[model samples]
Target: MVTADRRQGRRRADPPPRRRRLPESPPPPPRSARTWTWTWGTLLVVAALAVLLLGRTDVLPLVAQRGAAVVLTTLYGVALAVRTGGRPVISGALCLVLGVAGVALAEPILLSGLVVLTGVVSAVLGVMLTLPAATFPGVVREVLVAVVVAAAGALAIEGYAAEVSRERLAYVVLALSLAGALLLVFRLGAGLHGLGRRGSVILAAGLGAVTVTLAYTEALRRWASPGLLGAFESFVAQVDATLGGVPQPLAILLGFPALAWGVSMRARRRQGWWVCAFGVAATGPLAVALASVGLVTAGFSLLYSLLAGLVVGYGVIRLDQFLTGPRGRRARQLEAASAHRPEPRRTAPVL
Candidate 1:
């Protein structure tokens, strides 16, 4: 009876309904997806091998060969995307459209478009094939994958008869590769907030070094006095003659070390991806190295780069150990077990 007066004043509010409990994390991918991914990768590799071997022969028409190459390269990119956290169906559909367009634009008249597509494909393959590793040996394994992918991309780009300047092609490929890699790394590292003070400084310094090198080279080429330009070219020629070719500065100085240290860091933290993004400096130039320099010089150059880069990577690993790893050998071993958590399998989606 008294409740009637209470209702007139203000009825008691009902408690909000309990919301459904959400998952702590997304479920792992189905077994079928992983199996299909491996199947597709194997088939694509075989197809690519066949094309590379038979590409010069009359067994397949030139147009058909190039078309197959473009499609295969694009499909590999889609597979990489899926393995690196992309939706399989969507990436597949989008890559399919791009592949068709690439095949259609295979004519000499449309060479520029093909060059652009080649750059896109190479960048995608270069960046997506990489993952943060736990040790220097793992980083070396990743580098090998990058080398193979780049070589395949180089072959595909070289299939066309028309030639764009090597400098222009290299620049395009590097720029696109850097952009895509940075974007992916941003997501992988959990955005700007994830980059603590040390990470920010390291990333900034690395970027500055890369930018200055690129800018200085371009300026010397385009704006330096004729005498200076000639002198530079002469020096480069002498170096090439003496050493086959010097290791790429970008790869030796920054890319490989960053990859090594970043992966080591990833064993403890996510911010390592920010550093690893610079690895494209090595892989980007690699994609166009063969196309620009010819087989023998490119081979020697890559060999030198690998050796120098490994040396740098080793130094980086030791420095990281000094800074952050445990005090003694035994402690370090125990710390490694505690800090270096297991990651997803190489062929699985990391995210």
Candidate 2:
């Protein structure tokens, strides 16, 4: 081996280090998938719009109009599933067949005890679809989107104006929504395997709240003495008159807080999925806001409930931050060091 001379122009400068290239992000969904989504989405919107206009003009017969509404709502649910990274063509076709059968057998199913079952299942789906967010504002935005989607679903099912007593249509739409949301969340939550101890507790609590509330309400209606029932009704009426509308207690107490905290937790842990499941208390009621009450009454109730729930949600967030967040004089530094990982966009597939 030849040795270099120490005096040779200060030992020629070392070659510059090769520049390191950061890994590139994964490519977006295929072009064909995007094209299919856009095309299918546009078609659905146009068809739904046409149905709405014709129904308003009374050009479509009542039975046909209701049937069309159910189909459109089912299609909307299929679109929601596609948004969750499903194979659009396959899932859409399968759901369409089920939707047709639903329309044909709606009356028979309605006469059964589908209302309660549909309500609970749809509520669970509503909460799951809300997903998780990285920030408070992000959570709020997601909640708003959930509300808008629920409202659209409600509108799709309200095709029979004269048959005001037919609440079964709403349950059908709820069933469709439940089916779509479940298809994705089942995978996202990693099914039962992912629900560890904490997740199990949260889920149990959520189900308990919903079940107990429903049982209590039904019991009050069916078994309470007339005097007690009248007193309760009077109290509710008085509260409604005084406050313009009474907010749903479930929403204010459980749904909003659980959602806010759950999303915040999801930024840190998967257990957030369990907590988010409780958010259905709010979303489920909001889904049928128009169906359960008059337009004006629904509007007022929703406004009050939303405002109050946000306040409670904010409190829950603060409490969570206080309990689990960084502390001490170096808190800001700790937070900076523990910056959150980036999340996918709202419309993007999270799993």
Candidate 3:
């Protein structure tokens, strides 16, 4: 039956249908991504601190320390390769095998000798595996130059070692080898040309300082008084205390930010910059650890710090890219879509 109003061409008003209620979803289960990130980050930091503390305690057996060193070196090499866009898993396995072999071969020699041998071998392998294919010829030539220089330097060091007190020979050899390697890299590789005149001068000054400090320390060790040595030790202790008793090896972490920033500035290209950054990060810690242990002289610490600064600088740039890159754009798109979506409307019931 139709209403009289409808017969007269006037429609009856109908009540609006009740709005349907949506079931409330459980609050997004506590963002596991953030949780996992923080958990892993905390664990890694703790592990690093523990390792540094243990190393400084001088309680670990020498063999254990050497093994730890080999493992760390191999890991660093793999990380450097991966960060530079090379094959990571294969590089990691190769690094592990080569590092172990080098360490095993060096075992007949003293710990210091083993350190030098393993370091050199690891460095060579890292360069070979990580460098771009196009640079192979240049790298090969550089390798030849490096080998000749290293051989000559080794002979000189042997002569120097024979003449010096046994205590001083290791330190002297290590310092000279490091300086020589740096010089060869700068002279033969493209690094120096890229650095410009001012950078070159700075590098030269740093090298000079390292050499002078090594010589001065060797001389002092031969003639300095017990009182003077004690005073120096006390000063070092004070500095350590001021730094909250952080082991010197771990001090490298503090300089990461600065290193990444500097590297980004020097290497404008993304791929090149990342490679440079990882290289610096990996090597800088090794340098710092060596210097802290007196295996490398104090002057060389400046160079190591600079390397770390470069690594961290590049890291900063990478972080910026992540925040503004493709992923970031996608996230913005999702936000826009959600914001513009229309709400559901209620419909009137028909009579």
- lDDT agreement with native, every candidate: 0.72, 0.61, 0.40
Once fitted onto the true fold, the runs of candidate 1 whose alpha carbons sit more than 4 angstroms away are 1-29, 53-61, 105-110
User: How many clashing residue pairs, candidate 2?
Assistant: 0
Give lDDT: candidate 2, residue 1: 17
TM-score of 3: 0.38
Regarding lDDT, does 2 or 3 come out ahead? 2
lDDT of 3 at 84: 38
Residue 89 accuracy (lDDT) in model 1: 71
Question: Which candidate has the top score in TM-score?
Answer: 1
Enumerate residue pairs that collide in model 1: none
lDDT of 1 by residue, 1-351 (tens): 688977755655656679999879978769998788688777886787577547645576767666666666666666667657877677766656655665576555466556555655664565456665666677777767766676677766665434577777677777777787788878888998889888899889988988898898898888999999889789879989999975788888876677666766777888887887777777777666665666688788888887888789889877778786778888877776676656676677766
Better of 1 and 2 by TM-score: 1
TM-scores of the models, in the order given: 0.82, 0.71, 0.38
Clashes of 1: 0
Which candidate achieves the best lDDT against the true structure? 1
Once model 3 is optimally superposed onto the true structure by TM-score, how far is the C-alpha of residue 127 displaced, in angstroms?
A: 13
User: Residue 279, candidate 1: how far off, in angstroms?
Assistant: 0.7
Candidate 2, 1-351: lDDT as tens digits: 134565454456666679999999999779689778768765875676467547656798766655555555555545555556666567556545654565566664441223332333345434545655666787787667555555544444455332333334433433443343444555766787788876777677766776687678768878999999999989989988887777777778876777777776776666676566566666665655554565567668877877788889889877766776776647834663464645554445556
